[model samples]
Target: MYRFRPRVLVDVSNIDMSTSMLGYPISAPIMIAPTAMHKLAHPKGEIATAKAAAACNTIMIVSFMSTCTIEEVASSCNAVRFLQIYVYKRRDVTAQIVKRAEKAGFKAIVLTVDVPRLGRREADIKNKMISPQLKNFEGLVSTEVRPNEGSGVEAFASSAFDASLSWKDIEWLRSITKLPILVKGLLTREDALKAVEAGVDGIVVSNHGARQLDYSPATITVLEEVVHAVKGRIPVLLDGGVRRGTDVFKALALGAQAVLIGRPIVYGLAAKGEDGVKKVIDMLKNEFEITMALSGCPTIDDVTRNHVRTENERIKSML
Candidate 1:
């Protein structure tokens, strides 16, 4: 039997999604994840996204290979910004980026550990997608050699990736940044505990937005274990496949301190620059607030394992 829709407007009286990330207060815990090639999405690139973040009163994690430089985006908006660094073969090059981020007043350093090698994307490859040669790098690095000169994005990723990195380098990174350092790819409980023990500020429960390992479990599935491993030692954030406000509610219920939104925001930016991104953020926030109210969750703490059920029997039992 199908029930008729409620005639009255749904009341979102219980929406209180405010939270903090690295001591910075956000209107909500939702954040914009760092992705490469903002120029592909909008003419203003990171500047546009930064503006959206400012408008929504959210945070933005700017990628290392961004078309726009860190200073450019930082100056354009006062949105809480974190620098996402891709560890390279040359330690000095990595150090330069960290120093630059520090000078640019980035509040945190997000080290992406998932991509020891860049994963293959069929669309980018078939299109022969050479990312319109990073315009910002002109006076920076020698543009003589593009990241990929041959086959596709995958081949480019293969050559550009640095698999030789080790955890020991985290200490080296800590030495460079008084700003909080967050490891952005810890998935397993063991790695989560390691991050906690490393004395790092936080961990982002991620699978590189599922762009790295195609078959890896969705980020939401592994979030609880990571949160349990941290055991309140530090914050744990989720980033990947987050497309709606309900996704935020689900993530909060599963113990994610916050969630990071990616590609969708880019699409929004592509559609209409800053205003479009703001609308996307607004849509998610409104949906999350409504979901929390409908589910009888009035605050972040009101959301918990009790509000969630899983098809996985063992997992359901544990919850």
Candidate 2:
């Protein structure tokens, strides 16, 4: 949906893709987005993904529904990790997991605000897709309702998730943990502003991978709006539909602090192991570096809004 405005002869000899999020320096602006049931993708699950993130010198947001227990993933590697969560119906259930995450050395909490209820996935409905029991809530809560239904995700969310969750709960979460807080699943400038007003440390502009609400605006298309709304008060990140090196550059040009990868790395994990995951990251990093060199952006800060042109801008030029 966007094109680059490359600058020629910009001394492309050295390019650096490194950037930091909430004061932690990472090797690049690419972070691993939370995707659940890594074991279903590979036997190693989140453990392998954690190790891979450490190897890549980036962060991985562990899914609230991860198959690997928080403690297991925490002990598996020294990668900087953030825990993504959904507020459960049982208040203490969510509180206890957040406490465990903090005690286990997690750096931040990414509260997923989009899925108070599960979305309509026709494929899941057709094939009877079942959500694996979450290892994080093993003793605190259960997802073992009737067991045979493919709509287990629906069953679990209805029973465990608090659809009543709202902005006021941000204060409730902050009361329990000293870690920085980031609210994910916000797609509009309005909610983006609310996240900042709610005292969130960062905001992730996402549409739940376009799986939560169909025909929702693509995350990339709406990224600039959220970024503009935040007005640099907090770091704004984007996830969904990010599949290429150019995609990363496009997000940076539009004002994203970073871009998170979801499916590609998981595909890597399912195909090989940790090495496969690393390979996917390496390829993206390499391609992004080339994009930087070609586009006259030798550093992350060098990428600016002027470096890209949206279709609307192109049409406006004709006028």
**Candidate achieving the largest TM-score:** 2
Q: Which consecutive 10 residues in model 2 have the weakest lDDT in total?
A: 144-153
Kindly provide the TM-score of model 1 when superposed on the true structure, using C-alpha atoms. 0.89
Q: Which runs of model 2 end up more than 4 angstroms from their true locations?
A: 147-150
TM-score of each: 0.89, 0.97
Q: Report the lDDT tens digits of candidate 2 across residue range 1-319.
A: 7889999989879898999999998999999999988999899999999999999999999998899999999999989999999998899999999999999999999999999888987787667666766888778877755447566667777888899999999999999999999999999989998999999999999998899998899999999999999999999999999888999999999999999999998999999989999999999999999999999988999999999997899899899
User: Which run of 10 residues does model 1 get worst, by summed lDDT?
Assistant: 1-10
Residue 266 of model 2: what lDDT? 94
The lDDT for every candidate, in the order shown, is 0.81, 0.92
